[model samples]
Target chain A: MDQKTAGLNIAIFFCRQLDANQDKNRRAIEKELGLRIRFFPLPCSGRIELLHLLRAIEAGADVVYLVACPEGACRYREGNLRAKRRIMFAQKLIEEIGLEGARIEMVNKTAEMPADIGAIAMELLARDAKVSISPVRSNAVASFIEK
Target chain B: MITAERKPMAEIRAMLAPYRKILVVGCGSCVAECASGGEKEVGLLASALRMDAKIEGRTIEVREMTIDRQCVYEFIDQLTGIADRYEIILSLGCGAGVQAVAEVFPKMLVIPALNTTFIGETKEPGLWVENCRACGDCKLGYFAAVCPVTRCAKGLFNGPCGGSKNGVCEVDPDSPCAWQLIIERLENAGRSDLLEAIYPPADWSRQQGKGPKKIVREDQRSEG
Candidate 1:
C-alpha cells in the first residue's frame, strides 16, 4: 500500500453469509495492507439503513462499502437488492450534500470468493491514491487545528 | 392518504443555512406511509444536514423527532417542550401537518421539508398515484367507483371524450383511460343503463369555490 492508502480508514459492512471466516479475513487484510479497517457483519444486507451508512462516514470512515450476496443468492430472496437500493439512495443524499457518492459503495460477493474482502481492501487502497481524504474528516481536522 | 415528496435537497439546504439549531419534525401518518416524512426519513435527513454542515466547517445542531401524527393537536403537543430548544422547526409533514404545527407553535418559525402533492393511494411499492380529488361531491356510485375527476387527464363529467386509443388515455399514454375503465366496470356489473343517464354539470361550488372547507360533528365534540 502507498503512504496515502496506509493512512486511510475503511469500514466494510457485509452480509455474514458472504464470508464464513470474517474475523480471520479482516485480520489478514489489515495486516497485509497496514490500513485500519472495521468490519460490521449483518444478518442480511437488507438490515442496513441509510443512517448506518451515513453514520459510518460521520464517524470518520474515509470509505464505507457494503458486501452483499450475489443477486438471487440471498437466502432472504431480496435482501441484497434492498441493500443495493439503500446504498444508491445514501450515495445520492451524500452527493447532494457536496460529498463524493463514490465514498459509499456496494459489492455483490459469492460464497466461493472467500478472499474477496482482502481484494476489496486492496482495491480501496489503490482507489485512495486517486481520491483525497474525505472532506468530512479533513474539515473536522481543520477545525481541531484551529482550536 | 395524503402524499408528499421531500423538497429538493438544495432548497432544503438553503432554507437551513441560516439556522444553527434545527429541529426536524416528521409525521408518522400519511407522509410516513409515503416514505417522505417518517422517523427513518427524519434521521436520514438530519444526518445528511449535519454531515453537510461539517463538510462546510460550520457547526449545526440538528435534532430529529417524529410524532404519531402531525395534523392532530394531541400528537403535535409532543413537540411543545423540546421544540423550544431549537431556533427553527423543519417539518417533514404534509401541508396540513406543517400548518397544524405552526398553528400550535405560532411564534416558532416552522418550514416544510416536503411539498404536499395530492391525495393518493399506494399503487405499488414506491409508487403512489393520485386517485382522489375530494370534490366534496360523491359520484363514485354512478361511475363504478372510478373517479374521473382525478384519474382522467381532463375532468370530463360526460367522458370517453373519444380520445382514447387501445384503452390508453390520449393525454398520457402511461395512464389507462379512466372512462374506459368506468364503462367496462359498469358493463360487468350489469349497470350499463347508468351510462345512458347523463350527469348534469358537477356543482363546482362545493369544491373550493366557497374557499377552505370545514366539517363539524356535534356528537364527536365535548360539550362546553
Candidate 2:
C-alpha cells in the first residue's frame, strides 16, 4: 500500500525489516520521501528469493533497493547476508545479458538513522533518472507465461 | 538438483533460425532447479528470440510447453497433438529431455537451449554446485556422504593427492579438499579400516558408457 501520489511516474518496492520493525520502516519511508515507495515488509532479508527480485524487474519496477539492517544486527542471523548474495547473483545475470544491473541496489541502515532511509530513496531516484527503460511494447503478455 | 545456465541469446536465436515454427519446451525438473530451462526461462528465451530475429514472411510461432519431468515417457506424452504443430522443438531440459522429445516426435527437429551440466545442489538460491558423479558403485558411505568423485578436481578415490594443501584443492583455493573431508569423516566414524580396502579400478563400461541403459523390473511388469 502507498501513502503518497509520487510526482515521478514509477517507483520501486524496497523490502526491509521483519515483523514489528516492518511497519515502522514502511511508515518512515512514506513520511520522509513523500514518494510512492512500495515497501515489502519481509519476514527477513533471507526470505527474499532471486525469483522475487527478477520478477520485480520484469513487473516494471523502476528500481529495487534493499534496505538491510546492519550486518550483525539481523535477528534472523543471516538474513541480510543471504539478500546480499542474491543481489550479487541477479546483478551478474543482468550484466551478462547486456543490461545494466544498477537497477537493484542494497543499503545498510540502522533503525536509529532515520535520515539514511531518505538519503537512499533520493539516491535511487537520481539513479533512475539517469537510466531510461525502453518501455515494454507488448500487448501479448497474455501468452507470456504459457509454460 | 542440477546446475545450468542460459545459452547466449545470439547462439540460441541462431540455432532456431532455420525453423519458422518453434515450440519452446521447458523441463520443470532439473533445468527448473538450475533456473535455466524452466517455464520462466523458456518464456524469456522465446521473447528474446522473437525480438532479436525479426524474421518475416513465415510467422515465428512460439508455442511454449513444460513437462513435469521431461525424462519420463508418461510426461512426454502430454505433447501428443501439440508436437505436430511446430517445425522445430527447442528443449530447455537436459540432454535426456531433448532425446526423449526426439524419440517421441522422430519427424521433428529437436534443439537444446541449455547445456546439461551436472547433478548439483543449491549451494544458495540461484547458485547450484555439482555434488554427484553417479558412479555405478556408491562410495558416499565410505566418504562421509561427500562424493570425492564429483567434488574433487581430480576425482581422487583414495586420500588427498599431492595437490591438496591446507584442506583445499590445488586446482582452486575455493574448493574444499574432498579427500580431507573423507578422512575426517572416516576418523570420526572409527571406520579407518575401510580406507585400506583399495577400491578396484572402476569399470567405465558399466556406467554411462554402457550405451543408453534401461532398467525394467520383471516382477513389476504385467502381461496383458
Candidate 3:
C-alpha cells in the first residue's frame, strides 16, 4: 500500500557557504506543498559524503537530494564537484539494492536560485507522490512492477 | 607500495554465498592508497553486501575492520579475539596481506577481495602505473634511476631496441621509451660516463626464480 501523498518525506542538504538565507524559501515551499521537509545546513558540499546520503535513505526519506553550488562556484573550490561524485556513487549503491538511482540526486544551482531549490523539491515530491521509479535510464525499467 | 584492485561485486557475492557471517577486512596501507581497500571501502562494501542480501530476500551479517597493515603478524593477531565469529574473512589487502591473515588464522577461511596488481605509484588521482618488479635487487643507481625491468617492454639491460620511434615503446604506444628517459636523465646529470659502463646480466637469483625468497638479517634476528 502506497503512503498518502500528503505525507511524502524529502530530505534536502544545502551548503551554508552558498547562502545564509534558505529559511524563507524553505518555509514557503513546505507551506505551499504541505509536505515534510527536513533541511540540513552544511558548511560545504564536500561534507556531504555518500554515507550521509545512504543514511538518510535508510532513515525513511522518500527522496534525498543535495543542492550544491554551481560548478567552480564552490567557495572551497570543487566542493560542489566532490558532492556530485559522491551522490553518483550513492546512486550506484542504492541501485544495487533494487531502489531506483533517481531517488538520489545532486543539483548544481547557486544559493541565488532559491526558486530553483524550491522548484526541485516540488518536482521530486511530485515524482515520489506517484510511485517509486524504476531505474529511469535502464532498459529493464519497462518491466517495473508498480503497486 | 603494493597495489591492488577490488574484485567485482558478483564474484564477492559468490564467495560469500555459503557464509552467514563475514568480516570484510581492509588494510590502511597500499590498497587504501589505490582506492581498492581501506576503511572507507570496507564500510562501502559491507553496506552494499547487506543491501544485496536484503534485496535478494536472504540474510547475511557483515562486519568491517581495518588495521594499519594486514601483512604484519602483530596486526593480524589483533583479529584473534573476533576472528572465529565469522565464517569467512574477505580481505581487501594485497596478496601478501591475504596470505598473512591465512597464515595467522590457520583454521579460519580467508579469501582475497582484491587482485594484487603490482608495486607502483599513483600517476594522478584515480590513475596508477606499475613502476617496480621487486627483483630483490636494486639497480636504480646505474640506470639513471629508472627500472628497465618494469618500464621497458622487454626488461632489456642495454636498450633502445629495434622498436622505439618518436620516443614511444614498440609494445605500447602510451608508454614513452624507458631507455629514452634514462638517457635524458643521464645527459641532464652530466653522467654520460655511466653510458659506456654496460651492466652485466643481472643474476636471476635476486628475482623470484627459486622458491619463496627470504632475507636472513642476523642483525635484526630475534633469539629463539
Top-lDDT structure, candidate number? 1
Off by over 4 Å in 1: A2-4, A31-35, A110-116, A127-130, A141-147
Can you write out model 2's per-residue Cα lDDT over A1-147, one digit (the tens) per residue? 222323322333344542345455346556755433555556667777666665555444445667777888788888888889888876665544444577566666655545444454545555425334412212123121222
lDDT values, one for every candidate: 0.86, 0.68, 0.77
Kindly list the per-residue Cα lDDT of model 2 for residues B58-146, writing each as its tens digit. 34678888889888889999998998888899999898888988999989899888888888888876577789867676778877898
DockQ of each: 0.79, 0.10, 0.21
- Give RMSD to native, each candidate: 2.8, 6.4, 5.3
Of the true interface contacts, the fraction found in model 2 is 0.00
Tell me which residue pairs clash in candidate 2. Answer: none
Q: What share of the true interface contacts does each candidate keep?
A: 0.79, 0.00, 0.10
| lDDT (C-alpha) at residue B110 in model 2 | 92
Q: Which stretches of model 2 miss by more than 4 angstroms? A: A1-11, A14-91, A94-97, A103-128, A133-147, B18-21, B43-61, B122-127, B139-146, B208-210, B222-224
**Clash pairs (backbone) in predicted model 1:** none
Per-residue lDDT of model 1, residues B1-224, tens digit only: 99999998899999888999999999999999999999989998998888888889898889999999999999999998999999999999999999999999989999999999999999999999999989989799999999989989888878688899899999999999999999999999999999898899998777887578888998999978
Each model's number of backbone clashes? 0, 0, 0
Chain A vs native chain A, TM-score per candidate: 0.81, 0.64, 0.71
Candidate 1 local accuracy as lDDT?
Answer: 0.86
DockQ of 1: 0.79
Ranked by TM-score, top first: 1, 3, 2
